[model samples]
Target: MAPGKLVLATHNPGKVVELAELLGPHGLEVVSAGSLGLPEPDETETTFIGNARLKALAAATASGLPAISDDSGLCVDGLGGAPGIYSARWAGPGKDFAVAMARVNDELGDKSRTAHFICALCVAWPDGHSEVVEGRVDGTLVWPPRGGNGFGYDPMFLMDGQAQTYGEMTRAEKEADNHRARAFRQLVALLPARPA
Candidate 1:
């Protein structure tokens, strides 16, 4: 794996912190694109992996350093996978997830609530070499939302057979089996080993 500083290609503070925590133990000095003043690129790609790769490569090329990016969203089966790639956009310009959650519940009235969260992670080097991986977790949507811990649609997502929503679980609990962590586990094999 390439060493030295790595750019986390995201402007979302939640994602930046979450990804930084995952990358920290691997001995990489992590910096976020937002922190570096890198403009957020339009996610024109239709697939999660494609968007992840595009963002990663864009940041890597712009900063002349290796970069990592993730494109993730809730895919509700009832919505015909709507708000999948457009998850963030559903939150509107204010990024208000409450509104997004409400919209989901409103649109999904009396429909099957089966859903899944998918995450696609990409690592790109300044030379444009990149690797991407994806992970997912299935769950059901809940009404009125729940918990106050996690960000985005976490409050309304109850994992299969789990009592608590992602928003109700502690950081350690969420990271243990969430889609993002699942993707990170795969990406870890390609990363440099932890510092001795």
Candidate 2:
């Protein structure tokens, strides 16, 4: 039987909101570990899936509930996928995404603008069972970042064949076919359906 409720192992309000939206149609009650006073585990893993599993396992064990976690980042082809796991770190302690975006622009310096956003999702049960999936959206980098809607590097990322950056798109538009949404869809497919 599918779980009636699951814990989302994250503290980011944006992620909580987005994940809740994704999980809602599944009929699962989503609660964040942060709301339950669960400590945020350090992401020691190098890969996105590894980090996601680490977080999911930590939350599942600590809360005695099934937990889902995601680790996502932007990878610039010119930079050799640098700032992959360090995407958040690039924002530094204050989470200054502007500075991070600037760094990305400076690093590129007229090189290949190809880039992509990657998301890894992991669902872990208290009993140690877990499943993981990854999704990516290919795109190119843009300078003089545009719009002010989305967060992180959204303003600078223009998906292939799209004119507007993610930051310029409405939430509904961006959520459609996004990396996180794709990963979540895959995860949802693997979940057992709720008993009617």
lDDT (tens digit, per residue) of candidate 2 on 75-194: 999999978989989999999999999998999898898999999999988888889999999999998999998789999999998989999999889999899999988888876753
**How far is each candidate from the true structure, as Cα RMSD in Å?**
2.3, 1.9
What is the C-alpha lDDT profile of model 1 across 31-109, one tens digit per residue?
A: 9999899999999999999999999999999999889999999999999997899999999999999999999999999
Root-mean-square deviation of Cα positions for candidate 1 versus the true structure, in angstroms: 2.3
Model 1 spans > 4 angstroms off: 190-196
- In model 2, which runs have C-alpha deviations exceeding 4 angstroms? 1-3, 193-196
The C-alpha lDDT values of all candidates are 0.91, 0.90
lDDT of 2 at 145: 97
Give the TM-score of each candidate: 0.96, 0.95
Clash number for each model: 0, 0
Which residue pairs show collisions in model 2?
A: none
In candidate 1, list every pair of residues with a backbone clash.
Answer: none
